[model samples]
Target: MDAVSDFDPARYLSDDLLERIRGRAAAVDAGNVFPDDDLAELRAAGYLAILVPRDLGGAGLSLAEASVLQQRLAGAAPATALAINMHLVWTGVAKVLADRGDDALRFVQEGAAAGEVFAFGISEAGNDLVLFGSDTAATPQPDGGYAFTGTKIFTSLAPVWDQLGLHGLDTTSEDAPRLVFGFVPRTDAVRTRDDWDTLGMRGTQSRTTELHDALAPANRVVRRLAPGPNPDPLVFGIFSVFELLLASVYTGIARRALDVAVETAHARTSKKTGRTYSQDPDIRWRIAEMALAYDGMLPQLEVIARAIDERADHGALWFAKLSGLKHRAVTSAKRVVDEAMLVAGGSSYFTRSELSRLYRDVLAGQFHPSDPESAHSTVAAAWLGPVDPA
Candidate 1:
């Protein structure tokens, strides 16, 4: 990886680089293949080390900068951006911990600088409790390590990941229950199934993973806390970084859709009026509406990301804000893509059109963590307290 004195995403993610990535996005999606070239170029440009601290031989960028960079990357190729988000999440979490004076994940920064690819192994089938619950079994060993046995779903970068950062429930200990968080290196014990066929973002290749006695050595065990919401830094770091980065990806999609809309409007002419669609009042209004929705998302992302980077305390409200930002970004991006499809006319209906690919890609955002229901619930709970059980 190339090393730079300062973190400037625009410097690395140039218009030329973006066009190169964008050029391959359609083929990647159609073939459902991982963008090896995109990954190689990004890694070579030093993007993989954006969140690692300067001392650890990384760009040492803040979450705010990372968020902006993710948006730019996503605009070029949402699938690639979404897939890389998993790796960045781990590095972002390490940054979060280090900023709070807990250097437990310092090795993560070191590993990232050394080009170790870390995959997120949190999502599981039928586990809606997200971060508060787990079905994976974490069997404690005599040497303070853990043998994890369970299935992890939507494990992005499955084909290339070197280590998986995952969490599981430890029910064997006398304490009975604790959420065990650790990093499991790829080995024969960990099997990644060749699955991940999807309607959109196919290039992510987020396949299912089966762990049979996967081991996380004692030193790699990062945290063991109660399996529920708490003031734990681990929980905060994961939620904050994951949600922000996820939001950034969708926001980028919206920006790209808006640009497509503008270009299509200017190029297409109305036979009836003998003028470009850009001058059509109705078309202009539609573009404005897309712009209106798209504009609000980035500011919110920047605010929340900067707050996290600055270690600003919002108390319990942080959860609501973070989830809300994600919920809004995805929803708004979907709206922008929808409008752009309309602006692009019949051409966008073709499966090969970039806007069509974007249309499908934006849909996956809703299924990610902090879905609409969960986001509403979180914000409502923050404002009105939990619903009355009675």
Candidate 2:
């Protein structure tokens, strides 16, 4: 079989860099601390600008390339990849808009090139409405700026993000129900809580945020659209970048777990058979199953990413496709990790083992947006039509 070749993730994330991040993964997980040094190194390497246009002093890579690089990074440190995923989400959205000839988010690209970090603040406590609704209140000012009031949960990069891209419900105007999307800089109105203690992906420092009339200047206010699912370009831009990049991270986790399983199968021997576990039919079959599950995911991810980059239109089916890709990648990755643990024997059960950490880390994929239930509903509606409102 011919190898799939278009973009190599290692080109941006070199082996040496991967090793450096890998060396810190265990410690970060144990300490439940953010990967400060890792972020600095990635910043210095210009990874933060991977999706920014070349004219803006960035690497100018496409979404396909960014997805590949993220998978490679996640294989080494899932938390780092996941945390940085928030920043990349904004940049990727900018690229999507620019490709469609709407450059309203040029500030995001310019800020990224200048080394400014952007964090996502869309997720709210108990607000499964996702992009369709916002619990945060966006009050309009005479100067045209917005003062957003409310709390945001799971605010990744909380400790270090320079600007926050967020959304809120605007109830002040005659329209009265527009979802206002904008960027707010780190200032007195914004506060980050030191409450990031979690079961896994500890390095992300995804803490809770309190906003007391946090201000987004008029120029930074990007979109104000009617709340609900609509064909707005901003919605498409956000969903496409968010889902694809997220899928890439979990896919990398699967790759690493599969590698560990292979190594363990070769090294561990069966007492009665007097041979390596690799030679055992049951063990080999399990490994093959893992391989089969993981192999199917990469091509799906790559195809969707390439479609986004090439500006190909799937029209109404785009949401279902993107959500399905994310749902499948994470579920497959979790399955692969489970099989790997069994193949690696009892040694992998220890907390210090890399596979052990991955076991916990991959579980986080289930909590991300476009989750399994949501993905299934989207897909079913696309094929079978929306259920009648009786």
Candidate 3:
């Protein structure tokens, strides 16, 4: 059975589905390949529709429930999990825009349901976690549509994404700094360049996309929309969901590493002591520390999840609280996985071993925007009181 069968938010997350995803995890990581098969499974299982309303052919599960399901799946396969994460983020934002009478709603919803993947085109040119960059211009075409011409790096799922959730500034209206939010279809004009050969998340296929006058309707673009900003109530809820669930995945991978290490310990003897390595006190302590780290992540995640549910009736302050928990979960998960690797030593580095891939996969968790640095400014600003209207 799936680890979260009874409490499953949507019937989309099933034991059979997880098994299929797990089978591909190692192969994808080893070959540094996208998990196309796993994504197909997710589509078939309706995971893509978890947040969509039932009237719209979705499961319509709440933020609280969805977090539980995501956490379970992420604990097993993080690459696939992260890929799915982008989908939800874009879809959620699109849902709101559509409700705001944005013309692109129908296409966005239908496109997502049809497996037309959308890459969240955030984190623009020259972006360094502080300043957002984008020299790529969006100019109006005489045909009433806009032509998007720019370059975006670290574009996740770009290789297969059919649409892009683009963020840009509409310079045409000088009176207002119109921030454009909309979908850009992957037409012949959209070119992708190889760029995302990173130390981790290599399989995300996070390439750089170059757009040259991609055509789209005026209604297809909504100006003055922020994709996802800090301190929003949903931001905290989603951040907690992301950090804790990713941590859970690392913890699961670490447990697997620990399992392999213990089995090896039982079979091999220490060269100096002439005794099985499993019997060594130092070795035992290392194993114990790994377990402690793994065990700690679960309860901590639960605490944050529960808080989000309770505060849903209120406004955004709860999200700020969630940022703290997210930082802790991400940090603890990295430490656990690191220690798990140490227990296995050089053997864990072997390509044939599962621990090798698990180690590499867990490292990606560190850079997943879960740190306090991202949220410190926002949370502190809220605490200091509101500024005057200048």
Candidate 4:
């Protein structure tokens, strides 16, 4: 048995569930369709409610377990994995709201138990995602409610969201821009198209949602003085777990690439040498290098996961470290995919080869929120103190 099979982070998901997810991804890859069946399989497998508290009739898996499932999911289909990433974020924030005595928490929790899905609405049309703030406006309503009027772009899974979080300027506040977090069900507003058809992660179906004169109760609104700062820092910061899982997914893809490369080398005959390509020392070195990379990522992920589990009170430093880890994970994925492509030679790009699929999926994380440049800058600033570039 391989190490990944032995690790088996998804004890909750039966063999039937795992196979079904893989099959769905395969079908989506072939047909270039939305992973509706994949999401349904996850919901049926109880992964959609993995983060909900046990008292709320959820599985209540730990961060480590969730990370494992996410890694496995990414290995199959990164676009689907990226889309569902919002669920983990929402679950973490929802838990924090519950601790703050917010009434919306229970409803969200209940919805999770019922397999209802929520998506994020952070990045807007003109909002500098790295800094924050969009043109979207949310005005406090007369009946102790709020009216959300804005267009949100890059809203992953918007077409299927049951609950969505909108980040807009709170008209009631005067000082520094107030980062208002408002929750609204998709059924409450009209959605428009952002129509994200990119070079990679094409199947994510990320689109824009426009909310005009949408009414939201006070209980559902979460006002944060600073973005990404939740009432419960510990729970919210655990998203680093996703980063570690992403590393595992990249490693798995690389490992598969190495396997195929070795098989092809042994089978294909070199014209000049009249011998197998595997006989060449350069080919052997690439295989060894790939193995070394996969081995290194696994332990690092475990170390970080254990740290978060042990120290629930990690502060800004934790956020910085999580950012750094995510950067490293994606960077590793980039290198692994690049190396796999080289090792596979021209065959990696062949339409029929599995390496072609893995290569495309691996590049998806290169530009995610956890991109290396921003993450490294955040970590460096934390370490060297914030720079005043006046």
Candidate 5:
């Protein structure tokens, strides 16, 4: 057994539930639709509020524990895990702030406990500024609340997100260019476009969301800060939790691919050698290589997650480390999937094969935030300073 199997951080998800999720994954992907059944089961299991405080009707699991659960959930159904991750990100941020004695996001925790699904509305089309800035327009009202009007892309959990945790630029206030982070309830002002046709992870239905002056009430308006990078806990919480959870999803894909490959090897017999592929040195070595790639990720994820849980204070280097971890997890998972496909042979080429789905799903990993380019940039700056401002 791998080290990951031995360490369990979250125990909310029963093995039977994961098996059911796995059973539905193929049909969900085949239909290019949301995993509604999976969502219902998870919500019923109290999985949605895993990060909210226990007193708030949640399990009150730490971020580290939630990371492990995401990995497990992703191993069964990446799309479902990915969609639910959006909600968890908000709740995780709330937990992180609460751990540090800040309760500004107590509403988020309470909402999660009350079964309100929160979706991430940060990504914008061609908006590389991600989290630091927003292309969305935020106008303040006399009552102190703000109305946001803009398009937010990749809005996961589209079919069911009760509120959107989004950011926009407030250019009308005395502060002029402050970034306003707030929540908008599902209202007439908010519209979701059913345009989530993608190569893989289709079950997520991560549609584009358009906001037409969607209102975030005064109490729900969370953070207000300057346009670019700040040391606020909300920023830190979002970045850290988002990156780690994303990494765990890809890592789970890697684990699933490797498992399928191993199973294929044992069951398949080689015509050339008149023996099982598991006995073939080449197959054994390939599986070993996949395992090796996967082995390194668990420790990094666990350590980083524990550091966040313990508030170890890595300081300025935190962003770089988080990005690097995500970068490696994605790239490594891709590599493992590639090798697993080769090991599984011709059957993996068919779209129906689990490995084929894994291959397609893994491709989506590189497209997420802290992508390869930005990740490398951050690491380079950490080591040699910011490219001499060239």
Candidate 6:
């Protein structure tokens, strides 16, 4: 059962489906493989096309609705939710652009409705200049298309993605140092390495992708913007949706931990007091802290996502807000999971325990975009101004 009761994920996700996903999560994680079964079920339910317009044969949900659904899904299976997030992010970006009167990503919305699975391919090993720069080479073809040749790590949905939405640096172009955003289909030039061995989120199978002259055809080449923080709608759209969706996932994990902790507190009795841990002051306080953190996230996430959908202006503070939200969700989730472990006592420490799995899963939250250091720096720059190179 989910922690949230008032909202029903806009009816896009049914409780039965979520329960089925939850049932498969442990097995998937144990095998260290992708959740192919879950994916098939989600696709069959038209969940993949939820963001696509109704005219395009979709559920036509808003960003706020999407966030709620992602949270609900994450509560059941964090890795499944995380992996599907990549696909939803692309569709969500398309929605953001369409709302701003930019149809450059119209193909993405249409593609989603047509049963295509898109994956995110942006991360590079040793490259901290995320979303601002790229190490991959974007070579312009004679037909106005671009051929990408480089590696992208942590490519989620690695096993089943039909399209890889990625970016690369195009130094050879007329506008030198431009970052090219495009999509490439799986071809001989593109390869996915089976190197997804990890401590947690093992079900994601977020392997490394090798692009050796992988082509993004002219029509699919979406945007070419100069590197560094520009006010392009694409940038804001990606940043806003990515951060909000990610926060939703971590927040869901925290909610799950809190629920388990509550259950443990009521079910376990203390030897000294001859009563349940629910009566203990320390356990009660811990549960309250977890509840407070989980409660705190929804309002901000709900407001921000609704604001984006409504096209409200946050101006320059948008990045700071988004980054801060992601950071808070991750940190709070870690704290909640830690407290949950303690409340459950020694049995929770076992690998077979649900709390044990959650503990491992929540750790991956800190590793996502907007890490603690970067998030603090962003918030600091927003208020105190950027640091001087001198």
Q: Compared with the true structure, what per-residue lDDT tens digits does model 5 show for residues 1-390?
A: 133344454458888999999999999999999999999999899999999888989988877788889988999999999999989999999988999999988988888888889999999999898999999999998898999999999999999999999999999888788999999999999999999999999998999999999999999888899988899999999999999999988999999999999999999998899999999999999999999999998999988988998998888899999999999999999999999999999999998898899899999999899989999988888888877655
Write the residue-wise lDDT of candidate 6 on 288-320 in tens digits: 988988888888888888888999998989999
Which 10-residue span in candidate 1 carries the lowest summed lDDT? Answer: 1-10
Each prediction's TM-score versus the true structure: 0.97, 0.98, 0.77, 0.84, 0.97, 0.97
Error of 1 at 375 (Å): 1.0
lDDT of 4 by residue, 314-334 (tens): 566776777776666666766
Residue 1 of model 1 has an lDDT of: 9
Selected candidate, larger lDDT, 1 vs 4: 1
Candidate 1 wrong stretches, greater than 4 Å: 1-8
Judged by whole-model lDDT over C-alpha atoms, candidate 5 comes out at 0.92
Question: Over the stretch 1-390, how does candidate 1's per-residue lDDT look in tens digits?
Answer: 011225566785888999999999999999999999998888888888889988888988888888888988999999999999999999999999999999999988999898888999999999988898899999999999999999999999989999999999999898879999999999999999998899999999999999999999999999898888878999999999999999999999999999999999999999999999999999999999999998788678877988998999999899999999999998899999999999999999999899999999999999999888899999999999999998
Count residue pairs with overlapping backbones in model 4: 1
Q: Could you arrange the candidates by TM-score from highest to lowest?
A: 2, 5, 1, 6, 4, 3
State candidate 3's TM-score. Answer: 0.77
State how far residue 85 of model 5 sits from its true place (Å).
0.8
List per-prediction Cα lDDT, in the order shown: 0.92, 0.93, 0.63, 0.66, 0.92, 0.90
lDDT of 2 by residue, 51-110 (tens): 999999999998888888888899999999999999999999999999999999999999
- Per-residue CA lDDT of candidate 3, range 72-191, in tens? 576567677767767766655544334345434566566666666767665555554311224666676676567778877767787778778775555675543444555688889889
How does model 2 fare in lDDT?
0.93
- In candidate 4, the residue pairs with backbone N, CA or C atoms under 3 Å apart (3 or more residues apart, or in different chains) clash, namely 194-208
Q: Scored by Cα lDDT, where does model 1 land?
A: 0.92
Question: How close to the true structure is residue 10 of candidate 3, measured as C-alpha lDDT?
Answer: 40
Weakest ten-residue segment in model 6 by summed lDDT: 1-10
